[model samples]
Target: MQNKKLNIAFFGSSLVSAYWNGAATYYRGIVRALHNRGHQVTFYEPDAYQRQENRDIPDPEYAKVVVYPATQEAVYQMLEDAASADVVVKASGVGVFDELLEAEVLKLQSQNCLVIFWDVDAPATLDRVENDPADPFRAHVPQYDLILTYGGGDPVINAYAKLVAKKCVPIYNALDTATHYPVAPEERFQCDLAFLGNRLPDREARVEQFFLDVATKLPEQQFIIGGSGWGDKPMSANVNYIGHVYTKEHNAFNCTPKAVLNISRESMARYGFSPATRVFEAAGASACIITDYWEGIDFFFEPETEILVAKDGAEVAELLQGLTPERAKAIGEAAYKKVLAQHTYGHRADELEQLLLTTPRTATAAPSSADAFVS
Candidate 1:
């Protein structure tokens, strides 16, 4: 995989802004790791969703960023600019002109170059295509040279294979130690339990059950909730809502809480094997985490030792009942050691680099894989 540096062009949501874009941390970690490996990357993003107005970072030297107007002509121009790269990637949820970009990127496929579709949210995506027969993106599944997912493990792999995607790989999330490591606690973030995630429909119910409900059960315990759109939601008197924690503040947010909570969205919990970025961020901060029970968690973290798993509010309350600061610190330390050893974005980049080096380079296709998928 480290044989030679490849020129890569990436199209996705904002790389410099976490505003309304949950995949920003993921993009930065993976892209920066690839850069450290000596690969050159040019990132293309649309000027939409007010991301430019509320950027978490300035133009980074790791990747060349090209922000284009959200117009039809800009999509075509971006494709033309990326055509000469050794490998071109079109990531999911770019916010504008995504359909056009997804379909047209495949047209650049050739013998000397490879085109890939990287789905950052496979659980939601697979679920969407599964329910909708007339989905336009469903047809483009087989056109890309390979399908790469940020999470979703074997479930995602099998789903994509059924769609007859020539190949599918899961590049699970990991810590970027440089960005998300331990930080000194801040007074504003100190609490018994802290949870941070933007408000989305698929996740709100789960958050209510796992976080807000748990807060109600233990009225004596102080709880802090961060991220966008929760300011209006009713919460227990013991609960504190801090709106929209930025990427730079993630470490403090994780560290200040006695034990942070990680609740997956409904589709992700139903599909399993999906660990959100919060899990790693907490572990990196050496902050104990109580994550909702899901499949494949043990593969990443040892339950009851490295991490605490709770299936419902009752389970979370019980776990909190016995959790002392000393015990919490021990669990946090163990989780940190484990993730640093196996689950950082550096590790994910290595996995991706290997897959790219081994995948078939020619423009090719598998049969329409929607065979099992549609049924």
Candidate 2:
């Protein structure tokens, strides 16, 4: 896919801020890799003032960042940009005017351009659209040329097919090897177990079951939580709650933990194969990762050898207590090697390019399971 100089236009939430948005790292990684491959990319984001102020990067080097208001003029300008690009992608959960963007972006479909609906949280988005008959974007699924998802293996593709989506593909979360490599451990983040994620309604219960419960069961082990919104929650004496860890601190935070925990949101877990950005980030830092059982785990890493899996608090305690430092290091190294080989942003960029070039102009009415990559 090298030297495939295509102009790509992307519309999504803050690419500069990791404040409340989890897609920042993914957008940065994929966009940078695409640009490095000689594609001209432009990212359009709404004037989400708070996210703008809390941005880790005020400006990104890879893509031309364009912040637009929700006015009529801004909408027209955005459409113009999309119409001119070879491929235009409207990602889910943009935090503002997402319904409008999804419905209208399909209008840019033409012989020279392709329009895609990129679902970052496929499970949540599918739930909303499938359950709610009044969902405005329900009818627009078939209008776009292709549907791309961050995660959700066959479950997501099949669900979109039910909605008569033309074509659906899963592009799971991958590591940015250059940005998320090993780093020296920081004293503040040192702990036996660590879990980092924003406190959201769908995830807090799982965090309690997987993270907080395990912490309570093993009183002697040090557990750390790094993310926003858990401040008011009850904490055990051995547990440490750091309010928020910016993107720059991810490596140190991952490196400091003896074993990092990955607790998928309930929806993602139920659907299976939906790996959060934390999985790749932690693995890239060569941290021994212990994640809850999810389908398609084998697609990314070989469990027990490359990664560890735990079903409940008892298992979590057992794994944490059983592994020696040498064994843990070996597991982390194996996971790191697996991600570098098949689950990096560079790989995703190549997949995207191939998908774009190969997908039919007129998508089939029913989705086929033919186009899928496990990593």
Candidate 3:
């Protein structure tokens, strides 16, 4: 079975839309890469969260997508079809019926099938279980055949180990070369520095400290902030709020900026080794990237050369003050080459393929109707 082309069933937020789904890029990249490597993938997503109505792309040829209703019956119907799949993935944060899905996916586990709990936001999940002893998911963690995380290095792996997980691995985010690459600069996105991330509780304060604070220091420089939920937030006049940019415009968004910014969520920054998908996206677009300091960034790109690192808003201001277009281009080129060579989704897919083949399956017997979830 080492080289077997297994069938993979992915239960995620949405594969065809990114309206409010932050993990859409990560799903598209890895799934497309896996398809290219000859595996058959079937992505199942709930129709909740208005994702179907606001789809960014039609059904992709790479994976067969099944968009079911948000009702409990719909998940059960989907699980019946997923039972025989070689691998079944229940991702974190499906928006609706998440707890139901989390418990139900494990019922498909058997010697012939691998059931995985793929956490797109491992930092937040770990924080929750660590703080709450009665967290329901804590009991379910050790039962899965394998645990895969979006991007947490040692901190995440060890945390799972403490929960007695059979095996836990990190499948860090990566660039999709086909979808994210250099493009002609767009007038609307052109700015001194740009940041694109949805508004979230853990990230708001950091954004203030990094992007908004830096903008205050450089009153003359132009800045643009894109994403949902910042339409009314007060900010420096020099900073423009572009609001929710589509993925199709991502390359231009990154390329047009003199330098793009990346601010990790509070948990991710404290944990280290978690690089946001935007880091690779900007690097793939050959945009000079200025990111707030976090542990393990150097593991991805050489700082001060391939990528610029800043300790705080003051340091970010200083970096921007010194950055010239020519120097920015040189740094962008270096980053583009590095990511293409080592950090594309193809590379990540290869690692995942190996893990799937090597990780020993230690799941319990198939669940009975008596163990059915109560929703």
Candidate 4:
């Protein structure tokens, strides 16, 4: 007999566009892809921030959005909603009440609901839990039926194994082909080089080292920076800052730049194979890319032909100076082709489907009759 289509509940922090975080984009892409594949997805998020502010993309049609409060009653309501789901996923870093949500999800697992703790910020989560003996998530890891990550390849695998996750899969960041692809350059975003990333402690230094420092050395080039929390930073006249470009504008931002800059976070850079969403975004837009050195990069794209890798500001300056526009465009096109062929939300959804099929369903807790449904 064919297996029944699973009812899936995706619990993340924010589904609103105003948040405009990488996690929001990842959720939007993966959940939308899953819905396209005929899986029933109910997305749960808190209405802490009005998502309409600076909204870029329209609300998703495929998934149902549930806004919950920050109390135990809300947790109970979430569990009730997830009771019929074959898989209940608690995504990491859901800003407001994620800890409570995770606890409730874990409790539901005791009643036979399959629970997944999807870690978007694997490195930071692992580091935080590892350092604090009192961390609640540390003890709960082993209870989760599956662990999924957005990035952090080997290091994440090792860390989860140590934590005793039954199955840990790194569902790395991928291009949302429908949203990100080649487009005509827009005048507002036109620049010789552009970098888009939010401010984070681990990533700030690398940004300074690779992006800001490089800008100072290349006074002749017009560089652009796009993301949140850089308004206070002193910038050179040659470098322009565009605050928080939305998902809809990513293509224009990428296509308008001669080359886009990518700097991996400290843990991701150390673990390798952990390409950020921006790498695929710029590549999908057929924009030339210059990235900082990271191990296992060759597995995704050819260093010189598909994408340029720089070790420091000096290497960045050299690539900016030496690479011809034609050659850069050719490289961008190559990377774009590679990304469309191998890395997209469609591919990720397929991988996730396979993983779900292969993983043994936990039989410890069975859903109540009213909480179970047939597709």
TM-score winner: 3
Residue-by-residue lDDT tens digits, candidate 4, 271-368: 77788888988999998999999987887899999999999878988899897889989999999999999989999989888776556666666645
Once fitted onto the true fold, the runs of candidate 4 whose alpha carbons sit more than 4 angstroms away are 1-3, 18-20, 49-52, 70-72, 110-112, 366-375
Task: Please report how far candidate 3 places residue 16 from its true position, in Å.
Answer: 1.2
User: Model 2, range 1-375, lDDT digits (tens) per residue?
Assistant: 334588999999978888888888998888888888888889998877478778878777788999888565675567665667878899999887787778677666666677899999999999998789999889899888999999899999999999999899998899987679999999999889999999999999989988898899889899999888999999899999997789989999998788899999899999998998889999999999999988988889999999999887678889999978898899999999999999999999889888877666543232111211111
Count of steric clashes across candidates, in order: 4, 0, 0, 1
- For model 3, residues 1-375, the per-residue Cα lDDT tens digits are 888998999999999998888899999999999999999999999988778888889999999999999888888888887887889999998887888888888888877788899999999999999999999999999988899999889999999999998889999999999899999999999899999999999999999999999898899999999998899889999999988888899999999989999999999999889999999999999999998888999999999889999988889999999999999999999999999999999999999998777666655676654454333
lDDT (C-alpha) at residue 273 in model 3: 92
lDDT of each: 0.88, 0.86, 0.91, 0.82
What's each prediction's TM-score?
0.95, 0.93, 0.97, 0.93
User: After TM-score superposition, what is the CA distance of residue 201 in candidate 2 from its true location, in Å?
Assistant: 1.2
**How many Å off is the CA of 204 in candidate 3?**
0.4
Best by lDDT: 3
Weakest 10 consecutive residues of candidate 3 by summed lDDT: 366-375
Cα lDDT tens digits for candidate 1, 1-375: 449689999999999999889999989999999999889999999999899999999999899999999988777778777877889899999989888888777766776578899999998888889899899999999878889988887888999998889899888888988899988899998889999999999999989998899899899999999988898999999999988889999999999888999999888887778898879988999999999999999999999999999989889899988999999999999999999999998889888898777777765542222321121
Off by over 4 Å in 3: 363-375
Clash count, predicted structure 3:
0
